[model samples]
Each structure stands twice: as structure tokens, then as C-alpha cells.
Target: MTDYGHDLAFGSFLTPSAGTPEQTVSLAMLCEQVGLDLVTFQDHPYQPGFLDTWTLLSVVAARTERVAVSANVLNLPLRPPAVLARSAASLDLLSGGRVELGLGAGAFWDAIEAMGGQRLTPADAVQALAEAIEIIRRIWDTDTRGGVRVDGDFHRVHGAKRGPAPAHDIGIWLGAYKPRMLQLTGRVADGWLPSLGYLADGDLAAGNLRIDEAAAAAGRSPSAVRRLLNVSGSFTGSGTGPLQGPAARWVDDLTRWALEDGISTFILGTDDPDDLRRFAAEVAPAVRELVAAERTAPVPAAPVPPAPVPAAGPAPLVQSRHAGTGFAVVPTPDDGVRRSSRRVWDEAARPTGPAPDPARRYTRQELVGGQHLIDIHDHLRAELAQVQDLVEQVAAGSLGVGAARSHLNTMTMRQNNWTLGTYCESYCRVVTTHHTIEDQSMLPHLERADPRLAPVVDRLQQEHLVIHEVLEGVDRALVALVSTPTGMDELRAAMDLLTDTLLSHLSYEERELVEPLARLGMH
Candidate 1:
């Protein structure tokens, strides 16, 4: 029950059974107002009683602003990739990128067969699911020219381009239980969405063990694929769900299950309309309280991160930025060179950071399309080299007054012209993405693979916090300098303070991890 985004992942569903526009919107809105992490919708392909998931979600997307809209478990084999990609893209476009795809290979073979679709072998279904994902990603890459194309062993989808990607992160989740499907999930999904009871009978530990094993075989972190548990909205936890109980009690049980699974997201569904109401009114609050409480609590110090694995062959310098959400922190100049930066700040407050124009800042959706993730090796080498030189210079006491003044003058010039990308901007972009990948994706693996790395990782976490505060000070100074436009002295003072602190901090950090870096086969 280690703290692993339990607060962030606790989300539930609003089955489109009885939710009126007002009801669903009201519930979804209220959920976000209280910081409910996400909202999922159940997609029932053959169920006539339920509303079409696509139409219903578009309505929800228009109404809610912040909540992530996700598919509970979209059966992948049932839908063609081209069509599915288009539908998913449309939701992403409408929602501004708050859409997530929760897909499953589907257990309802008879259901599809009844609908006149072919009955799929389990192997075929999984293979089809794999091919579909490839095709869908391609469609996202290109425009809707000839639609989408999927020429695979199982299927060939041609043409299926959709416009306008999602505004925020559109994570893909795979619902898996068995080994093969779970393996596929590990290989292909942003998360492993499990179909399990919170406190089911007998030992479910076997599945957990296998999940970890399969994930390893795939050379992926079990954590790489987030764990999501789908459950009934009302939980009495007598092993029978929607058990008659007060909503608060049910929510508590749900949280308990989430913790057990090391999962934070719970996709809730119920037949009774009142169950949804009860969840929103009485239950959801208790869950959010726990979530908020957990978030505010101090994180346990993680061990030092293991050295990054060296790639055997030449890797792309930056894989399509579309490979993941948003941009990887580049070693590029952190100047406010991107015009959209300053424009954003001026509208809200005087330009504090380079990005003055808060009005035109790129959200995750817009940041997509050709940008790529900088390879971890390429990233570490440059940043480490930049930091190492400064650290050694400061350590040598040979960095005398002349050298200091020279460095300070150059920094001042960059600040004056607003053309210089300061350490502050570089640090912010680097940390925002760095923290996400390391703490969320990388740390877990390091902890398991090399216990030796624990202390180093702990120190890095401390560095992250210190750097964050330093950058905040940088932002404050930058804004003041811009508004008055004569604060070279102000700029000099800020840079001196930042540079001095950075030198001392990074020198110690470099010594601590330089060996690890070499061990990892990185420069």
C-alpha cells in the first residue's frame, strides 16, 4: 500500500443510464470543484439500454472544464481502429485533450457474434487489439486525408484521419486479467485497467505477481502501466457490490480496494440512478477527503534512481513528442523566445516569466504534433555537462572575481535583451516533465532493480524541491525586471544568487551520482 498516486487515480464512472444533462453535468462539475481526479463512462457496445458512449461523452465534455473524461473499458476488438481512432480523437478534440482511452480485448465474444460480427479467438482478439493501437497512433499523426490505415495480419484500415487532438493528456489504458492480455497491456498501454473486486474471495495475489512478471518480460515497469480497478458505485464489500449501505461507507470501501490493488483510479458503475446521486452527494466527498489528505502528506523518501539503461543502437534524438504528452525538457535556450510566453503573463499580471502572454500559452494539446521526447541519454549528457562545468569551476576556488564578473556580465546581457534563456526557464520545463517521468515512471523500477540507488534518488528529490524554490525567485525577478526594464542590477543580483546556489547544490549532486551515471553507461 505504498503511496502511488492513490489520490490522483481515484476516479469513478457516470453510466449514461439516468443522467440527464443537468444531472451528469452537475455531478461532473461538482466532482471537479472538489478535486475529484477523473470521470469515466461505461461503453456498452451491444447494450441497447445504455446511451451511445460517444454521444453522451461529447455532452459531458462541453459541460465540464477540468475533469478528465475516460472510457471505462472500450472493447478494442469490437471496433475498427480507424473508426475507433476517429471517435477517440473527436472526444479529445472536443474535450481539449482531457480524454483517455480505456480499452479491453473483450470477454463478450458471444455478444459481438450476436451482433453479426465474427466471433474472435482470444489470440486473434489480442492481436487485433495490438494492430488497432498501431493504426490509431498513425491516424493521430496524419490528417484525415484518406482516413486511417491499418495493414496488419488481422486487419487493414485505410484512411481515417481525425483533426484536432485532445487538449490535455489522452492516456491509453488496457483492461487485462490473463497473462497474454496483461502482457499486451504492459507492452502497449499507458495503464493496466484491471477488472477485480476490492476484497474478492481467495488470493488475487497470483494475478499481481504475474502482472509484475509479464511487465518485466516486456521490459516495462509494472508502474509504467497504471493500475485501474473498475467497481460498482455502491460497495458494501461483502464481496457483493452496490451492497445496500450509506454512500460514505461505500466510498471508504472503494478506497480500501484501491489501496489493496496499489491502484488509485476506480471506475464506478451502477444500475440504480439513485446510486449515482448518493455517490455524488454523500460518497464522493469522503473519497476526495482521503485523496486530498494523502496528497498533502509528505512523500516517503525514495531511494536513488538507478542509472538509465544505455541503448544498444542509435536511438532517435527525440521520439515524436506525440509519443508522450507534451514536450520533454530540452537543453534548448530557456529564453522567452517563444512569443506566446510573454503574451500569457501580460494579460493576467505584469510579465513575471518570459511567457508574458498567459492568453496564448500552449496547452498540452497544442504542444503536440511534431515535437518529440528528447532521448534520456541525449538529455542527461547535455544537462549534466552544463551543470558539471559550473560545479567544477565553483569548487576550484580558482573561479576568481574576474571569472565571476565575466559570467555575471554575460548573464546580465541575456537578461536585458529578454533573448537569453535563463536557468529559471530551463529548470521549470525540465523539472515539470522530469518530476513526472522520474518520480512516477522511473523511481519504482529503480527501487526494485537496484537497492543501492535508494540514497542517491533521495538526494535528487531534495534537489528538485530546492531548485523549484530557486526558480520561483527567478520568476519574481524576471517579471519585475520586465515591467521596469532597467533592473540590470536586479537581474545581476538574482543571477548571482541563483548561480551561487546552483553551483554549490549541483557540485555535491554530481559527486554523488557521477559513478552511477558511468555505471548506467551514460557519459
Candidate 2:
């Protein structure tokens, strides 16, 4: 496999439906809530039913704290390069670098002409897009000494003052599929953004080759051009239809796309909150862990002798036995600081990992396995916060129960009382899957390696059962909350119980496992 070594990223491609603008923005918020990296909306200004993509992006950016915002591919024909540059830069600056520009050549000539935009032939549109890129980049180069000037056939700017520079280096991602656009992307653009629907089954590899060749010809490294895709698929519990199968199929398919196609950024296109949550909480993390394992796998190499430490003046105070080898120091939370009120389990019963042997070191494989656990835990933590937020919204009457329930149903995507129940069910399934893997695979392996770890593993397994009960309790509360008029207290109590049990269990597990996982190894 060709490892581009580019850090993999995931995002969402939301539809900017005018009728459900609030829902669109809420979906973007959900993306941020569940730890997605970016959120984008499609731009089709001529469409009467769609909201203005730029305004929608601005609103989403303002609403979200972490997730980046962008247009799926802004229609360049409608937005002049100078104005588009300023608008993008302004948003990027306002959002504190959480903005990316996805630009496209003009499409649908009749609609473009109707909207008071010039209609260009296909070749001319591509050429114009190239010129627009040059103009946009020149406008954003605030440090350049002279006034910007680019004389092109389609767009020409003469001696225009440079930008109010963006907060960060904004990536110019091109929505490209044709060879010409792909080559142009390699030559100048920072990323290649293409929707899966537009590409044939085998087009990804061939497109990558073209981009790589053009990048080489342009004296730029192929890795410099980030490959980002806008993907859409359904999630079904049974039957195979692309992403309609189980979560395992998604993990496998996405992992292959990363390894073989060199696509580092995947933006899921969906309006459903449940689908978005599943993509973020389950599919994203699993793909990351699998890819990380492969990427960090040990490569065979000849052994080399360590350099002699000079018979120096003083001995080291904190000598690392793994001095020559690079091993990252693992992190942990501070002691006994509770963020919530309720308690589910006693913390004193928790076990700790074995003490360090200073002389003993960790293998790469062991470290990867340990890190994967933490990654999964992080996902759970984020989802828990979202669950709490939803509960509060329901209690406050800010989010109607019916509205919330509608979001929870992936099968129907309609309003119902099972929104909270369905959400809790999906989330509980994720927690169960995590524990099942540890109980069946990881704990057994660790116990086999060192008999002393048996106690810790046993405690962890017991906690898993406790957490499962806590999850069931939350489910029971949801059922009651839906049935009773004054069940807000029940909902809050259920969540608090979950918070206490899950957080404590996760912290305890990480504390006891991080070291052992690194030293003893994981399957």
C-alpha cells in the first residue's frame, strides 16, 4: 500500500435545503458535536429551493465551535474571483481558520444565463476557473509588495490592492473529475474534492495517477495535493448495497479507499442526524484505528548498534531505557474531578496498570493497540455529551419531543416518540461493541501474557457488565419519559447515572490498560 502519510480527516456534506434551513444548521452542529472535522453545504444559487450557500456556511460556522465550514463547491460563474476571495477570506478570518474553499467550474449554462451570469463553453469554463484561482490566490497574498494584477482571457484584475489576509492558509479545493481539471488541480490547487456520484467505479485510481503525473511535471510533490471526497451511502442492519450492510463493511470499504485511493478526507452527504452520528461515532473511529494499525506496523530492518554514551561527567537523572527509540508518552486525566452530580459505581474498586519496569520498553504493535482504545473512548465521551445536551433541550422544551424523535429514526426519518430511545439504543450498541471486543479479545490476551493482570482484567470485565446495566437503565428511563407528562426528572436522572458510570469506567480502564497495552501488547 502507498502511504501518502497525510493525516486522514472526515467531514460532512450537508444539503442547503431552504425549507429546512434550521435543520441543516442543526445537522452541522451535530457534526461538531460528534467530532467531525469539517462541514460543507452545496452551492447552487440558481436553485429557488436552496438557501444561499455562503450565508448558510456563515451561520453554520458561527454556530459550531470546532468543525470547519465550506461550500461543497461554490459556483465560480456566479461569484467573481475578487469578491469570492474577499468573502472566503472574511469567513476564514471570522471563523478563526475553520473555513475551506471548494470551487467548481460553471455548470448548467441555461440556468447560469438566467441568473445574470455569463455562460461559458465547457473548455472555457475550465480555463476561467484556472484564471479565477490565480486571481483569488493573488488577492489573498497580503505580504506581496506590489498591487495584485492578473491579465486573463476570462477574468482580469489590474493593480488591485491585496486582501485583508485570512486567519490561516485557506485550501483551494477543486471539484474535479475530468483530466483537464484534475491536471489543473495538481498544478495549483491544494486539494482535489470530488463527489462519488460523479465518478465511475474505477475513476478514483486513474484520477490519482493523472494528478500525480501533473504534480510531478509541475515540480510539486504528489502528496501536496490532498484528496478529499464527498461520499453518500445508506446504513442498513441487513442486506448488502454499497454502504447498506453492517458497520464492518463500512470500515472495510473506507479503509481501502484511504489505503489505495489516497483519499484522506471523506465528507458524508446526508441530512439525517442518526446517519451523521453513526458515521462520526462508529465508522470514522474504526476506519482510523484500522488504518493506524497498518500504517504503524513494523517494517523489517537491519539492526544497528547504539552509539556509546561518552564516559561523561554526571549520570542522567531520568534516563529513558527507550532513549534511542521513539515512544510517545501517554496522557491521562487529573485525579477525582467530577463534572457531573450523580454516581453510578464506586471508584475505589477500580484497578491500576502494572508499575513500570524502567528497563522494559514497548513495541510499536502494542502501542497502536493501546492508542486505539483511547481513540474509541474519546468518541464515546463526545457522544455522551451530545446525549446530555439533547436531554437538556428536551427538558427545557427547546427541542420538542416529537422533533427529537424524528431525528432519532434512521429507518423512517419521521417524527415519533422513540427519538430518545432510538438514539440511546444506537449509542448503547456502540458501547457494547467496544466492551465485547475488550472482553473477548483484549482482556484475554493481556491475562495470558501476565497472570498478575488477571485481577485488573476481571474488574474491567465486571465494570463492562455494570455499564451495560447503566445503558439499560437509560433505555428504561427513555420509555418512561415518553409515556409520562412530567418525566423530565426521569430523563435527567438516567443521563446522570450514565455519565457517572461511563466516565469513571473509561478513566479506570485507560489508567489500568495504557501501560499494560503498551508493554504486554494487544490483539
Candidate 3:
């Protein structure tokens, strides 16, 4: 086995479609919302049907809060190393240190030449890429007291000033396959990125051997280079093939790749939103869990040493002692305040989950799964508060409706809006996505794990439908606000209903499901 001991990362490789720019960016944001680690786009500057990858990366970074962005493999021939270095550094600084560089030697010579890039042979291309990597590294080395200098046949940077280091030590991954490129990757690159479709049987093993050998010869550890693969597959209900069956199948395949092939990062090249959701909510977590178990599994002959026991001590006495429940997670309580007289569902009719057994003990690690659900809900709550604040600012004439609309539109929250309408719409979409994930993935898993919780799960799903309608009502109010301009009361009413339903529903969910999730886990 060739496990590299790298922490597993999941990501999406999206197409920057010019035809549906909004959808593309929305999918990128969804990757972050669903807990993916990275978001990448393929670079094809010569293609008219695609958005410029660099520009799209900038927009995606702005739209998302915490997802690394990169080009799958930027075409190095078309982009100069010196300028690319500065651009990557600037974006890394702007995005709060979430940028990775994926570089590739030139491909599609005819298109590249047509776009004013130099055409070279395969050997020359590899050599040129090496020179570009040198130049790019030199440009980022601000601590070195002198101008960057790299003199090569393909690229020369003579006395070029080097400053503006990236916010973090950005990883330079290479899309390499050939012997020369593999050797170069092992010697210098931080990662090896290859598309699964480009590799045949045994190709990964063979390539790893070459890279490992090269790394050893260059006085470096083979584990220094992280392995990332771009994968594409379909999600089916039954067994089809590798990565083409259910989420469990994908997890099994990915776990094997991680343990045996040392592939730590799996980037799915998909455009379907459902696939993205399943990949994040199901496959990613399972793979991480499985890989972790195996990595920490005890060896056959070498038994692990027992943990040291604490010294015995007398128990402290308390005045008013009572039996305690093992569950420690505290659900957010509903404030029971309403801004509007409207109500979506009967609050008293909500079903309660079965009470947890006081005898059951839960580990801190196990309880974390329940806390994670609360963390996600807290983020939604914060965003909702921001939406309300923006609305109040616009209402008080502190923020211009046109300027707010323009800012949101530039972020691609929605196509059209007035003042805080787009921000509100974005928040609505996030709420909808969270509910959809619960309705489709988490609720089903919970139902299977604990049949006694059926009434609670059913009620949650029903509330999800009601919230969907509330969101649609918000959308309508936004449309009216755009046309009538004096429809702030209607908009405010819609927001009030949303706040009421969403907050109440979230608290009910936490109260009911937290214990079960802690006991049964999120699988």
C-alpha cells in the first residue's frame, strides 16, 4: 500500500459555462455550502463558449466564504509566469489565503498558436514548463533580497522585482503524465493532478513509481507531492461500475484509492447539482471516515500500548445532586417573537422525538456530529441577520437601493434585484439548499437508523415544504418591490414570516435530532 498520510480533501471541477454564468457560479457556492474543500474550473482561454477561468475564480472567491479556488490546470504557454505569479498572489491575499496553482504544459497546439501562443514540441513544452515554474517561484520569494532572475531558452525574467507574497504558502500543482513531467513534478511541484479519464489500468501505480524514484533521487520525500485526481462518474441506485453505483460505491472506491494509491484529493468533474450534493453529503464524509479508520487501525503484531490511567481520588460531594443525561448539546431556543401576524404552521402540533435514555453515555467525539448540525444552522442564522440589517439600511436611506442592487448583482447573487432583494434571495436559496439536503439525505438516513424518530422526521420534512413556500413568497415580494418601489411593507411581511418559520423549524430540528445524530452518527 502507498498511503501518503495526507488529509483527504473533496472538491468540484466545474465548467465555466458562458451560456449560464449564474448557474455556474451558483454551483460553486453550493460546493462551499455543502462542505466541499475546493472549487476549480478548467482553463480554456481560446474557447469562446467558456468564461475566462481566472475571472471566474475571482467571482467564485467573492461569492463563497470558505472554499479554495483554482484552475484545474492553467495553460502555462498562454500565460506568462511573472504576471501569473503576481495575479495568484493578489487573489490569494484578497481571498484570505484560499488559492492553489494548477499548472500545465501547453496542449492543443493549433488553438494555442491561433491565440498567439508559441507552439513547441512535447520535449520543449516540458522544458518550458520547468522554466516557468522556476520563474513563478522566484517571483514569489520576497524574502530573497534582490530582483528575481531566471534565464532560460523558453522564459527569461531578468532583474524583475519580487514582492507581494501570497497570504499563505500556495501549493503549485502540476497536471503531468509523461516521464519527464512526472520527474519534474516529483522534484519541484507540490502536487500531481491528473484526470481519471486520461489514465488506464495500472497507470496510477506506474506513475507513482516514477514520481517516487525521481523524488528520492532529488533528495525529497515521496509524500511531499500530494496526489489529486479529477474524477467524473454517474450516480445510480444500483451497482453499475466503479464510481457509477451508489454513494457507498464511490466511498469504497475512493477509500481504496486513498489507502492503496495515495490519492488524497478527489475532485469530481460534474455540473449536476444533485450529484454535487450527494458527493458532499454522502460520499465525502464516508470516505474520510473509512480512510481514517484504516490509517489508525492497530497493526496485527504490534499491539498499541494502553493509555495511562489516572490516580484514584475521592469523589467530591454536591449539596443537590440529580441524575444527569449524557447528552450535552444545547439546542438553540426559539425566541417566540413575531414581527408579522402571519403564521405558516401550528407550533403546538410539532412532534417531539423520543427522549434519550439517561443510561446512554456518548463520547465527546461522537457528540461532535450533533454540534456540527448546530454550527451549520448558526451560519444560516447569521446570514439571515445580515439580510435584515441590509434591508433596514436601505429603508433608512443610509444605503442607496441602486448601489446595493449593483453590489449584489456584481457578486452574482441573482440576476436582478432592488436594494437588499438580491441578498435576501441569496439567503433564501441557502435556506432552501439546507432543507433539501436534510429532506433528501440526512432525514432518510435518520429514518433508517431509528424508526422511532419517524414522526419527528416526517414533521421536519413537512416543515421543509412549508418553508419552501415561504421562500417563494419572499421571491414574489422582491418582484413587487422592484416594480412598485413602495412595497417595503409587503417585503417586510414576507421576511417576518420567513424568520418565524425558519427559526422555529431549526430549533425544533436541533432539539429532536441532536441526540439521535450524536448516538447514531451522521451516516
Q: Which candidate has the top score in TM-score?
A: 2
RMSD of each: 18.9, 11.0, 10.3
What is the lDDT for 102 in model 2? 94
Candidate 2, 163-216: lDDT as tens digits: 989999999999999989999999999999998888888899999999999999
**Winner of 2 and 3 under lDDT:** 3
Query: What's the alpha carbon RMSD for model 3?
Result: 10.3
Better of 1 and 3 by TM-score: 3
What is the C-alpha local distance difference test score of each model? Answer: 0.54, 0.79, 0.83
Of candidates 2 and 1, the better by lDDT: 2
Question: Candidates sorted by lDDT, descending order?
Answer: 3, 2, 1
Tens-digit per-residue lDDT, 1-523, candidate 3: 6898889999999999999999999999999988899999999899999999999999999898899999999999999999999999999999999999999998999999999999999999999999999998888999999998889999998899996899999999999999999999999999999999999989899989999999999999999999999998988876666788766667767877897899999999999999998898777866765566566533223212333333575322110010145456666777778777888789899877767775676776667666767777777787777776666655565454555544554332233345367467656766765676577668889999989889999999999999999999989988877677566667778888888888888888887887889788877
The local distance difference test score of model 1 is 0.54
What are the runs in model 1 whose C-alpha is more than 4 Å off? 2-7, 18-35, 142-150, 158-164, 197-204, 233-260, 271-523
Model 2 C-alpha lDDT versus the unseen true structure = 0.79
Return the TM-score for each candidate structure: 0.49, 0.63, 0.60
Steric clash pairs (candidate 2): 405-419
